[model samples]
Target: GGPAKGEGQATGGCPVYSHPAQLTDNRNCVLCMTCLKACPHRSVEFNLRPPGIELWTTHQPMGHEVALLFLLWGAVLVHRLPEIAERLQLPQLLARFDYHALATVVLLAAPGGVAWGLYQLNRLGNPCLQGRPFVQVAYGWLPMVLLSSLAHYLTLGLTEAGRIIPVTLATFGLATAGPIWVAHPAVIAFLQAVSLLLGALLSILLIQRIAQQPWLRLLPLHGMTVGMTVCLYQLIV
Candidate 1:
């Protein structure tokens, strides 16, 4: 033989089946085929080589839900701004009436509506996005949409009625209670933080369920939330 070749054993890092004892650590594993035949759990399988079963699951895919969400949000945006077909910076289209009101609604509603829709869409499709990414994106976008919408209405509020609030410096002054002056900074911060945390948690839980039964997912809940918030703004105004 070659120099020092016979001195090294060829342990090929493969299971050897020369004897039944070599296949299992349990000494009582008789070489009977009965155990393999009768076992329902399939806890033991004879794999001469590891296969690619780990990469596959029998669960169904639901990518359609994501697409539906996208469509729904698109429809909402178009519905909110019926003049979108005109005010899209098209030179010929801009000859009509002003689209500023429609543009304002779209600007206020589109971001959150689009973000929520996308979050739902991703959850419908992706099992892996069920955790932190969902939380972060949802929390980040929802409040921006909501608070900005509030600001929009607040502007309207100021226009509808003259400045009902008088300027005063005393701590007991009632002027601080109205929109003429901003609320206490601490109170605003607390409300914003709570809303963000709740929105994130709510989205995560919904997506977790969607991961289980994608067919059970629906758009009514999202639509209702959007509608309700808009209604609340209407009430506030």
Candidate 2:
């Protein structure tokens, strides 16, 4: 039988039952392959698409989803907190709080606060813009959030990942001093810079597409994207 009524079913059956094309926007899909295995017509399939394409497409984002996007953005910054605190000489000021607690606050507050400020600036520059500015612009930053995190993790993967060989051998009591391959720090830094640049470009494009506003009004968000790219570059590299 087809997907049941009032069960959150839409135009297609993909477990979540959202239309197949809309799966990019459906956060509930767990990719369990239930529909792929069960479809009688064999019409279910996967297609390769550009990352962050969904950010520019039509989808009504919920409040929680928007909030989560900010959280994800903030998470990328959370990893650099130690270096940040050190450079700014904030250890003494922050000594009263636990490290984990401070990180939690940064994770929860930083991105949202920045976004809110940018949204207000954008609205101030163009008062005619309509709708909830925060929700409207939230998804536009997804590419930045995702690629920055990827770039951050790429450093670990490139440098520390080689240790898995010797570490695994040690775990099995077969310790050896044979050389293992690790990418050069310079190479990793170059790649991280490239990743951030690409993310910033995609973010600018997505913001333009999503906002549909004049360049003058969009300047604040564009600046924010560029600023974030620079900040992440400094933090990671």
Candidate 3:
């Protein structure tokens, strides 16, 4: 409904999905500081930093960011569930819509929960942090997590991404050649192993750098890192 008399007009907005051209047309933006200067709360600041080092730092994330990562992890699992189901020969019950819900919950509470718990383990090993939230240090562990994600997605992209193009094009009365390229199973396997092992090594180094404690004090969490990597290796390879 339109605004009543004496009410201010509603601001017009465009849906990103409906008007993707708006996002693609960045010509109107001239790097002007108008928005930053116009903010009432003065919450904006800018700084420069070295690339990619922040992911390995011990700095914790906000509560919502940690929660966001949990949800993202769940989404990632949902995206990969078909492959997972195929490998495990999941029961027919998984064909139901509820399976996505179940898988998301399981992924969030199980693997994602373990990653969050490691922040507590870090706290326990320190004992100096009494009142701080665990979310702070949790995302510090994301370098390996994100790297493994890249590796996983890269394999899928190289092997499977091209297949959809022909089907989509055919719907529009177009024809295409065979799949762009399909790497050999052995080659994909080799790349997957390299990515997983490299991620594992990076995770170990991240733990050592961020934990800054003797192994005995942080053994459990370190073990969690190693175990997670091993599970990932088994799952993918």
Per-candidate TM-scores read 0.25, 0.81, 0.62
Worst 10 residues of 2 by lDDT: 1-10
Best first by TM-score, ranked: 2, 3, 1
Candidate 2, residue 27: CA error in Å?
2.7
lDDT of 1 by residue, 1-237 (tens): 112243323342223333333442332344555434333443555557322121122222234433343344334344434344444545442344555455555545564465566657756765553333433323322332344344334433444343344433224465454545444545544454444344434444443343333433434334444454443333222
lDDT of each: 0.41, 0.76, 0.61
On residues 35-131, what C-alpha lDDT tens digit does candidate 2 reach at each position? 5544445466569987655665657667888888888778787777776778777785346667757666866688788878878876776676773
Give the CA lDDT, 0 to 100, for residue 35 in model 3. Answer: 41
Query: Could you give candidate 3's per-residue lDDT for residues 1-237 as a string of tens digits?
Result: 114333333323222222223333322355544443334444567767764454445343467766776565555556566777877888542687787677767876665677657667666667874533445445545655675676678777777775777767777878855456677878887887788678667666655655555656656666776786676677666
Q: Give the deviation of candidate 3 from the true structure as CA RMSD.
A: 9.3
Best by lDDT: 2
Work out how many backbone clashes candidate 2 has.
Answer: 0
